[model samples]
Target: MKQFQNNSLYYDVDVKIIKQSEHCIFYEMRNDEGKGSIKSYQVFPGIKLTYNDFHMGQCPYHNPLHKDILEINHCREGRFECNFINGMYTYLGEGDLAVNTMVNNRIIDSTFPLEHYHGVSILIDLEDAAKMISPILKDISIDLYILRDKLCAGDRCFIIRAKNSIQHIFSELYTIPDEVKYGYFKLKVLELLLFLSIIDTSEQFEKRTYFQKNQVNKIKQIKQFLTQHIEYHFTLKELSKRFDISLNSMNSCFKAVYGIPIYAYIRTYRMQVAASMLLQSQYSITVIAGNVGYENSSKFASAFKAVMHISPSTYRKSH
Candidate 1:
């Protein structure tokens, strides 16, 4: 096994895509064990994004070294964990943007939720990016070198919430038409960088975790247990007590690890289970709902429609 220090950051991260279109390239990402159906996208030169469904059950951390570039990651659907080399943990929740600059000294790895994690990543090549923006910032006292220093000099990762400006940018990226995505992506990428550069960096940083490893292992266990038991009901208090952790600790750590709260994860997993049952089993809708922990068929139907975007019967008929 090669040590992370010697490995290329882009190595092993290059997904093999069997399909290609004008705007997006589709690829499948497998686990270390080599049994996977995880599908992701490679958006041109530097951006890689994934629109995952119920996949990626065991994705190990990636700490590869890459050329100097800044990665702007956004969490649109479920959550994902982005960990820096210095022990700081940043959870990209829904509508959250994580700004990380890739450095040779500091490698990184990220874990997506067990299911339903959709996000976009835009990588700006340091040389090309600086050339485009440094002149623009000449009158302003800000330079790409300064921003680069702040991002990579020490332990810093800028975590921005989903405000209107950020939201609108991602919204366009998410829904950009296929014919225009190639050019539109370039424009949007630059637009987003300018937005980030202008933002007041004073309050854009959050220092939450410097992980101990064992605690993170416990949280991973929590995710594994909940995903396996889709029929069971879980509460924060019950889980925290059962796991010998404080409620706040459980909440924050779970968010940090899984990108959403415990209950929200449970709910998403429940709907996924129901979806599979609808397609695979001969059971009626009422029985299927009860099997996934819902007593009232109507309520189960509502929740299923909310997550899967169709009623049980409709889904069953289609699939």
Candidate 2:
């Protein structure tokens, strides 16, 4: 086991890598009060784990770590407020799991000590995770669309149970003989994966309106292709030809799953990309528009305004 420790609110934290393999790493950490802790993992490239702790009587401040992190917080104990970029605040109780997609802006507030309020977090590399779940990615995407913006408490319970099971396995590692620990740890990890798979399935069944696994998978592939080539103008006919589906069928699939047409999704994706560039880069309006596949700056501005209700220039200025 490798151990790392520090002692500063801005940087103080300790991590112990209990076990590691080619595909996954098992680690634990204690974060500093009023500070955020972030660590990247080689086990799953492109994935990182971050932990933040807030002392009682102090409110957690917003600390921006510029990366697309999928935060999974399993609140071991205590109450906290999750403040999102959209100005929505969620109250998280003990045994709750908070999934935050690091898209725009977000923060967490806790009125408890670092040790008192603890949680386990797992960050799966987006591309790697996509490949690992490729067989079911489309179904998951469709389920996400149907479940949009609602998290059931039962889902949280399932996640908590899985987390605890993993923790329990870790806790026994030292007590048990080293030879037994290896075998038991492997078993526990397999069990955890199976539990996660079951949770994913349950969430899908509970949330999705239509659950055609095969069709959903195809839609996922299309979405992935579009995301990869967002700069290129893609027509329904072109996409249909490439995916071997009729134009009508392609459009219907997208609409049924995402509640939007393919063109609308592309336009929205372009605007979102442009918005990010405007906030994070020094690129000019015309350059940003063209970078996101908009040939005409005026056309891009018009489409952005239609969805956002604000001009691109104004939006950039405000953010």
Which stretches of model 2 miss by more than 4 angstroms? 1-211
lDDT of 2 by residue, 5-28 (tens): 211221213434445554334444
Candidates' TM-scores? 0.71, 0.36
lDDT at position 38, candidate 1: 29
Runs with alpha carbons beyond 4 Å of true place in candidate 1: 1-9, 17-67, 131-142, 151-153, 177-186, 207-212, 284-286, 294-319
lDDT of each: 0.66, 0.51
Best by lDDT: 1
Root-mean-square deviation of each candidate, in angstroms?
5.9, 19.0
